[model samples]
Target: MQNTPPRSRIEIDRLRKIFLAEGREVVAVDDASFRIDDGEFVALLGPSGCGKSTILNMVATLIAPNGGAIRVDDAPVVPGRPIAQVGYVFQKDTLFPWRTVEGNIGYALELAGVPTGERKTRVAEAIHQAGLDGFDRFYPASLSGGMRQRVSLMRTLIARPEILLMDEPFGALDTHTKLDMHSVLLSLWERERQTVLFVTHDLGEALTLADRIILMSARPGRVKADFKVDFPRPRDAVKLRETPQYAELFSKVWHSLGEEFAKGRSA
Candidate 1:
C-alpha cells in the first residue's frame, strides 16, 4: 500500500507559552494553533527569538504550554520528560565524545534493554542508513561537523520514533556543509515517513526541505503565513533556487518575514 495510514497526528489548539525573564513574564507564543498530518515535513520559520524553538519544545513534551492544549495522536501533552513516540534533533550534535559512533547510536536501545543480539542488528541498520557503515568505531571528535551531525541523526533514528522535532539542527554549519546536510535529511525523511516539525530561521532551508512552511511573527509569535511548497519530491536545494516558482514563493516569504524582522529591530 503506497498510501498507508498516517503514523501519527499532531494538533495544537490555542497554544500559548510564557517565561519569566528578569522577574517579568514575557509572552513567547500566543494563541498558536496548527495541525501536522502523518508523514508531513513542516518547517517553523520566524525571526530569532520569535519563539519558534519554544513551540517545538512544548510539542516535544520538554515544556508545557501555559494555556491551550497540545495533542499527539489524541493524547494530551503533559510535559515533564521527553515524549515516548517523539525524537529530537538539536542545533548542535549531542554526540557523546567518550562514545564511539556505534555506541552513541545504540545507546538508547541499550537503555531500553533491547537484547544484545537484536540491539546490534538495529544499530548496524541505523549506521548503514546514515552512511556510517565503515566508520562505526570512529569517535565523534575524529569526525567532521557534518559526520557528527549524521551520527546524531542516526542516534535518534535507532529508536524509531514516530515523530521528529528538529530545532535548527543545521544552523551552525558552514554553507557548504549545511547544504549537504539538507540532502542527507531529505533522503532519510523520504524513506522513514515520520511526522516532522522543523524549526529554522533560514527561509531557504525551509523551502529546500519542508512540505510546508509555517511563518511566525516577532515576539509573542503567531502564525503569519502558511505556505505549501508545491515542489515535487527529491528536490535539490541548489537546483530548486533557480526555478521561477521557487522565485515567486521566495519573494512572498521574504516580504512577510521582513515585516517581523523590522518589528523585532524596533522593539
Candidate 2:
C-alpha cells in the first residue's frame, strides 16, 4: 500500500492568542493568518517575546488559540494530540540525558510504532542528514551545545513529519556554527522540501533560508510586512549578505518593524 502525500502542510486561519497577565489582558497574536505550501520554506520574523513562538506553538498544537483555528492537511490540530504531523525543534535542545544520539533520534519513531528493526537504519540516516555522522554513540552530555542541537534536529527529521515547526533552532549557536548549521539545514530542506515554519529574530538568518519572510509586529504580533525572497536557491549566505538587494530587503523589514518598536510596543 502507498501513502498519499499531504495536500497542504499548514494553514493558520484568523489565529488569535491572548494571555492573562498579573491583572491585564495580553493578546499575544492578533488575528494572524498565513499559509505554508507543502515543501515551502517560510520564516516568521519578529522581536523577542513578540509572540513568534506563540504562533509557532499554536501551529505545533502545543497551545490552543483563543480564537480561530489551525489545520494540517485539512485536519484540525487537536490540542495535545502528540503532534505527529509536526516535528518541532525548540530554541533549546531537549534530548534525554540517558539516551545516546541514536536512541534520541529513534524515540519518536518508537512512539509512532515503527518497528525496532527499522529504527537503527532511520536513526543512522538522520544522523548523517544532521551532519552528526560519527557522534551517534555519544551521550548528550558529552557533546557541545551545537552538537546537542544537531541531535535534536536529527531526532525531529527522523520522524519525517509533514511540517517542521522550528523556534529559533540556531539562535543559541555561535556565529560560525550557526552559519554552518544554516548551510546544512538549507541543503536538507532542498533535498526533502518539507514544509517549514521557522521563527527567528535574526534578519540575516531569515533572509538566508526563507523563501518568504513574514515580518511580524511586536507583542500581540501581527503580520506587518511580507517579502518574497527573490534570490536564487542554493543561496550562499556569505554572498547574499553582501548583496545590495539583501541589505535593501533587510532595511525595509527593519523600518517596518522599527515603526512598531518606536511606538514602544516591542518586547
Candidate 3:
C-alpha cells in the first residue's frame, strides 16, 4: 500500500464574493485560490480596498463567501465558528478598556471555559512570549502604542490556534516601532511555527517577513504574482534591507504593484 502525500495546511478553492453597493454590484474577490503549507509565512499584498481584508475575513469565516470553499487542515469550515481553528489579529487594537493586560490575554481562555489554573499558566506564558512580562497589570492606556499592540498580539497567541490571520497589525505604529515589532513578530513566528496569512500594504514589511509574497490586483483583487523568498531564514530586518538581492526583489515587486496602483487611481 502506498501512503498519501501530506495535505496542505490551508486550501482555498474558487473563492468568490459579490456585494450590493448603492444599486451597483461589486465583485470583491473572483475565483481567488491559494494554498498554504504548515509553518509558512505568507503575505497577501495589495492596495487599499483591494479585497485582501475581505479574503482574510472569509478565510477566518467571519463572513461567508458568495461562492467556493475554504478548508483548514483538510477539514471544511463551519461558518460562524472559525475561532478555535484560527487566531486573528486585526489592524485595530480591540482590547477592552476595562481589562488590564492580563485580563485581556486571559479573556479568550475564560470564554472557552478553561480552568483557572490553566488560564494563569497560559496567560503568563503568552505575556512572556510577547515580551510584556512586566506590564501584566498595566491598562492599555498606560502603555505605549507598540506595547498595546504587543498585548493584543499576546491575546491572540494565548489562544494557541494553528493558523494566524493578521491584517496590517503594525500599520498604525511609527517607523521605529514598526521595525521593532517586525523583529519581535518574526521571532515569535519562528518559534511557534504557525501557518500565518498576513495582509500588509507595506512592500518592505511583506518582503522582510514573508517566506512567500502573494501580490494581488488593484480593486477586485486576484493573485497577480507569487514569489518565494530566496533569502536565508532567520532574516535580519535591517541587514536584509541593505542587501543587493533585497534591492532587486524590492524593485521588481514595486514595479509590478505600481501598474495596478495607477490603474486603480484611473478607475
Candidate 4:
C-alpha cells in the first residue's frame, strides 16, 4: 500500500510583497515562509506596519504578491481568484447598519442561495452560538462594539470556511470587552476547529488564543521567531493569564517581540 504524503492546510514559501507609495517602492514582506497544518490556530504577532495584515490579504487572494508564492492545499493562490475555503474578519466590525443581527449573520447563506427555511435555521444557531439570541432583531447601530463584532464573526463562521483569517478583530474593544470577546472566540474555535491565522500586536491576545505564535519583524516583515504555545486546549482565555506558566512564556515571547518594537521605533 502506498502512504499518503503530509499536506498542510496553508503553505507560504518565500512570500514577498512590495507596495508602491508616492512613486516609491516599499517592501512590505520579504522572504516570509510558514505552514499552517489543518485545524491549527496560529497568531501573526508584530508591531504596526509589519506586513501582518498584508500577509493575510495575500492568503485570502485579495491582493497579488510582488514575489514568491502562496499555496492552499498545494494549489497556488492566484490573484483575482479567492479561495472558497477561506473567510476573513477585518479590524472593524463592518456590520451593515440597516441589517439586524440575524439578517447579517444569514447574509452569506442567502448569497449562496440557501433556502429561506434552511438559512433561518442556520442563522438562529449562529446567533445562539454567538450569545446574541435576544438581540437578533436589533440593528448593528444599537449593539455595543463587542456585540457588533460577535455578529461580524458569526457572519463569516456561518459559511463554515475551513480557514479563518482575523485581522485584529477585537482590537477596538475595551479591556473588559476584549476579554469577553476572547472567551467567545475561544469557545467557537474549540467547537469549530478551523485553521485560523489571527493578526494582532497584542501579545496577551496571541498568547491566549494561538497554538503557536509566529513573530514578525518590523517593516519589511520577516519571520522573527516561531514559538509554540503549549497551553492545554479548551483554554479559559481570562483565567489563562493568572497562571505562572502563561506569565513565563509571556515574558519570553515579549522579550523577542520587544526588540522588534524597538527597531520599529528607531526606524
Candidate 5:
C-alpha cells in the first residue's frame, strides 16, 4: 500500500516569548507571525538574540510560548509532546561517542524495533546517501567536522521525518566545508522535499537554500520582511553569489537586516 502524504504546513500566530534573565523580564519575541507551506523550504534569518531558535523550539513542541499560538498541520502545538513527524538538527552534532557511523544513523530504526537485517540495509543506504560509504565503522571523534555533521544529518533523515527543523547546523564549519554541506543538503532535500524551517544568521546561506526568507527584527523579535528567492533549483551555493540577481537581493536584505543589527547594538 502507498503511504499517505504528509501535512506539514506550519502556522504561527502572534507568537510571544519572554525570558527571566538576571532578575529581568526580557521579551524575546513579540507578536511574531508567519507560515510555512507544506514541503516548502523557509529560512528564518535575524540578528543574534532575536528568538529564531525559540520559534523553532515552540514549533517542535519543545517549549511553551508565553502568549499566542503555533499550529502544525492545523493542530495546536502541545508542549512536552513532540510531533512525530518533526525532526530537529541542532547547532551541535550531538552524536554518541560510543557509536560508529552506521550505529548512529540506524539508532532510530533500532529503537522502532526494525529487524537486524532491515536496519543494517537501511543504515547502509543512509551511509551511501550521506557520502560516507567507506566510513561506516568510523567513530565521530575520528571524523572531520563536516563528516561528523554529515553523520548527524543522516541520522535525522533516516527517521523519515516529514518536517525538518535546522538551527544553524553548519555554523561552525569553514567556508569550503559549509558550501560542500549545502550541496549535500540540497541534493537530499530535492529527493524528498520535506518541509524545512532553517534558522541561520548568514545571508548567503539563506539565499542559497530557502524558497522564502523570513527576516526578524532585533530583540523582542517581529517579522521585519519577507523575501521570495526565485533562483532556479540545483543551485551551486558558491557560484550563485557571483550573479547580479544574487547581489541585488543580498543588498536589499542586508539593508533591512543591517538596521536591526544597529538597533540591537544600541539597545
Candidate 6:
C-alpha cells in the first residue's frame, strides 16, 4: 500500500477580491496565490491598503473571494462560514466589556457546546498559557493593553484550532510591549506547531516570527515576491534582530516594500 502525502495546511490559488467604492469597482487583490505547509508560520507583509487583511479574510472565509480558490487541509473554503479549524486574533482587542476574562475566554467554548466541566479545565489551561491566571476574574477595562491582547489570544486558543490567523495583532501596543508579545506568541507557536498566517505591515515582526514572508504590491494587490525567512527555528524574537543574517534579510525586504510604498504615494 502506498502512503498518502500530508495535505497542505493552506492553499490559496488565484485568489482575488474586488470592492465597490463610490460606485467604482476597486480590485483589492488580483490573483494572489500561495501555499502554506502544515505547522509552518507564514507572514503576509505588504504596504498599507495592499489587501493583506483582505486576503486573510478571504482565507478565513469571512469574505468571499471574487475569484479563485482557498483550501484548508484539502477542503474547499466556504464563504462567511470558514473552516472552524482556525482561530483569529485581530489588530484590536475584541473582548466583551461586560464579561470577565474567564467569561470572555469561555465564550467560544460555550458556543461550541463544550460541557461546563470540560470548559473549566480548558479555560484554566488557556489562561495559564497566556499568563492571565490571576486576571481571570477581572474585566477587560482593567487590564493593560498587552494584557488585553493576551486575553484575545487565550480566547482563541480555547478553541484548540490547528490554524491561527493574526492580522497585526500587536500593531497598537508600545514598542516594548509589542516585542514582549512577540516572545509570547512565539512560545505558544512552538508548543503546538500550529499553522499560522499572519498579516502585518511590520517587517521586523515578519522577520522574527515567520518561516516565509509573502510581499504584496499596493492597491489591486498581487504577489510581488515570496522569500523564505530561512531563520533557525525555536528562535528568540527579542534577540533575533541582532543577528547578521537578520540585518541582511531586513535590507532585502525593505527594498521590496519601499517600492510599494512609493507606488501608493504616487497613486
RMSD of 2: 3.7
What is the C-alpha local distance difference test score of each model?
Answer: 0.91, 0.86, 0.90, 0.95, 0.95, 0.92
* TM-score list, all predictions: 0.95, 0.91, 0.94, 0.97, 0.96, 0.96
lDDT-best of 3 and 4: 4
- Segments of candidate 6 deviating more than 4 angstroms: 1-6
Answer with 2 or 4, whichever has the higher lDDT. 4
Total backbone collisions for each predicted model: 0, 0, 0, 0, 0, 0
Question: What TM-score, to 2 decimals, does candidate 6 have?
Answer: 0.96
1 against 3, candidate with superior lDDT: 1
How accurate locally is residue 189 in candidate 5, as Cα lDDT from 0 to 100? Answer: 97
lDDT tens digits, residue span 1-267, model 3? 999765588888888889899999999888888899988899999988788999999888888898889998888876688557699999998999999999999999999999999899989988988888899999999989999999899889888888999999999999999998998898888888899999999999999999899988987888888988778889888888999999999999999999989989998
Lowest-sum lDDT 10-residue window in model 2: 258-267
Kindly list the per-residue Cα lDDT of model 4 for residues 100-191, writing each as its tens digit.
Answer: 99999999998999999999999999999989989999998899999999999999999999999999999999999999999999999999
- Residue pairs that clash (backbone atoms under 3 angstroms), model 6: none
Candidate 4 TM-score versus the reference = 0.97
- TM-score, candidate 1, is 0.95
* Candidate 1 per-residue lDDT over residues 148-172, each given as its tens digit: 9999988898899989999999998
